[model samples]
Target: MSTHFEERSGVILCRTSWGSWYQTMEEVFIEVNVPHGTSGKEVRCNLGSKHIELHVKGQEIFKGKLFGTTVSDEGTWTLEDKCLIRIVLMKTNREAGNCWASLLEGQYCADAWVQDQMQRKLTLERFHRENPGFDFSGAEISGNFAGGGPDFSNLQK
Candidate 1:
């Protein structure tokens, strides 16, 4: 249902799901855990071309315009580790019927990267493993895109 990213004294949790209707977007929620007694009182993020909204202590912090897929933004902040923590909600378009369908569907290659406090950078190379008969239509229709479905006995190998 979700994936967890953890490290010493901190954790980054991420959960994603498909959304309703013609939109059929993938929604992602993230929570970052900081260490105790640290408080600069700010938060920063870099969400590339996905809608995002922030909240702290059960209160709305920032509300930004909803840009379908063209605009992207980033921010940084300092805060207490024991604080309520920060959450980022993001949504991206589905691959079906879209221009990038084949590529987004894992038929191609993707590149990714990450950085740590030591300024060390990690690069990743990825490719999609083919699932011949997998039906993505259900995810395109219903908001529940978590991935359990009927067997693909009908799909040709």
Candidate 2:
């Protein structure tokens, strides 16, 4: 959570000395930078249900537990541009609003945008509680309401 992350198109991204990683609600994508002429044969990547180990040219790039469980058998990796190792990991949990706080456990945290989104949801829920008959679950509050809060005029009840 070193304030070195950004959110783009709903994907949270973080960069490290080795490379970068981004995640959607359903999957985590990692890109590791290797030597310019590195080949797939020089890469060693192991995907476990709760851990991952990646090595390039016999050098350990990363090896640690993941932030969340993933379907290891469905995970895949490939060497692109002869210098980049791209990996795709499918999450075991795909419930709505489910998102990883980071790629690795206790590592980089979610971007501020994600935190803001969560805050907005909490604010909406508070408004809903104060104004019954109005359903705010999953509601996206954008712009300003007439009373400077959630518009309850269109209450369900």
lDDT of 1 at 96: 21
Check candidate 2 and list the clashing pairs. Answer: none
Ten-residue stretch with the least lDDT total in model 2: 1-10
* lDDT values, one for every candidate: 0.28, 0.68
Question: How far off is model 2, as Cα RMSD?
Answer: 9.2
- lDDT for model 1, on a 0 to 1 scale? 0.28
Candidate 2 residue lDDT tens string, 1-157: 1111112113335767888786544567898889999988888899999999998989989889998899999999999999889999988975323456667887655576754453354345446555556555546677542223444557786
Please provide, for model 1 over 29-109, each residue's C-alpha lDDT reduced to its tens digit, 9 standing for 90 to 100: 333454454344444433455334444444444445443442243322334346534433333442222112111223221
| Predicted structure with the largest TM-score when compared to the true one | 2
Clash count for candidate 2 is 0
- Per-residue error (Å), model 2, residue 137: 20
Deviation from native of the Cα of residue 59 in model 2, angstroms: 0.8
Q: Which numbered prediction scores highest in lDDT against the true structure?
A: 2
